[model samples]
Target: MPRRSYDHYCAVSRALDVVGDRWSLLVVRELCSGPRRYSDLFADLPGISTDMLAARLKDLERDGILTRRKVGPRAGTAVYELTADGAALRPVLDSLSTWGTSQLGERRATDAVRAHWFALPLGRAIAQRIPAGTATVHIGDSAFHYVITEAGITHHDGPAATPDLELRFDLSTATEVATGVRSLADAIERTAPQVSAP
Candidate 1:
């Protein structure tokens, strides 16, 4: 089938018109996390000036991608929300994040901080298997240990002394498997994951 062409025949050009410059997608990402007051959004995204943030938001609103609502009961109170169209970009963002993580060669403290926390599928897997124990997960160069007790979940850097199970994987495979982009059964069959029972 022939590709459906835009009027300009330049998808990148059209997308740029909506989210062209810096901070536009980031603002959309922030809104995707949840509804936020303008101040809160500004605070969460570091290094974005108040004026630039406002301008980007205005542009998105103009493009019908975002909508600003008067949140509180009183006057002068407002919050930003992603429209249905805007919210549809979440999968794109998640794929980008997963891809970005896979491409990083030298892991940094921030990457550790980010991937150090479990993705939802991994979290659910760990939570189900070890209701009252700790486990260390090593995926590529990233490592993090989680302690699950009667209290709650506690995270630590690096491997645990002794874990009930050690789940080892390459970063990309692990991410794809965790996010359901790739099947876990397929990974198991393909030996993409090295699972150790302790």
Candidate 2:
């Protein structure tokens, strides 16, 4: 099938033509954490049907937003990762994350949570307040690590080798911090989620 578009020439419309699908940006959000195997993506994304996931992945690839790559010396598996053009969407996602914060009142029974989903919010919060370093965030059984530098922050799903700091927070606390309901320091003070320095 051919790609759909409004046939409009405006830049915003053009960008949306590439990313306007229901799950397109979420797929980008998943990739933002790190390269992920096909199954990895399918698993993390709770409600996306297998077919829809496949379609979105293909669309993202065709649009040059992400690429499929072989991993390991054996080439036994493949993973999806963002291209530079795709990675540039981080600021956009961040803005959305910030904007959407207000609407997050509570997680209903239907809501799904993934610890690594908080990576960007945590990265942004830490980056603003602290100097360059790494932090391994422990959110319950799940954990992820992120690197902070002058350029920006990026994360992967798992613990870091030797994170300069370690932070532990529950999902609610994370939500509060992520949504701007609570500042990072305030969240730390309220919940007193463990924060340790190397």
RMSD of each: 11.5, 2.0
- What overall lDDT goes with each candidate model? 0.68, 0.86
Clash pairs detected, candidate 1: none
- The window of 10 residues in a row where model 2 has the poorest summed lDDT is 189-198
In candidate 2, clashing pairs total 0
Across 86-193, the per-residue lDDT of candidate 1 in tens digits comes to: 877655665665565556555455543334323434544566667878777777776766677775554455788988767777776676666556665575556634
**Model 2 CA lDDT for position 167:** 80
Q: If scored against the real structure, what TM-score would every candidate get?
A: 0.52, 0.90
Number of clashing pairs per prediction, in order: 0, 0
Best by lDDT: 2
Writing each residue's lDDT as its tens digit, candidate 2 over 64-182 gives: 99999998999989999999999999889988877776676777888998877777778888777666888888888888888888887888778888888778899878877887778
Model 1, TM vs. native? 0.52
Off by over 4 Å in 1: 1-8, 105-198
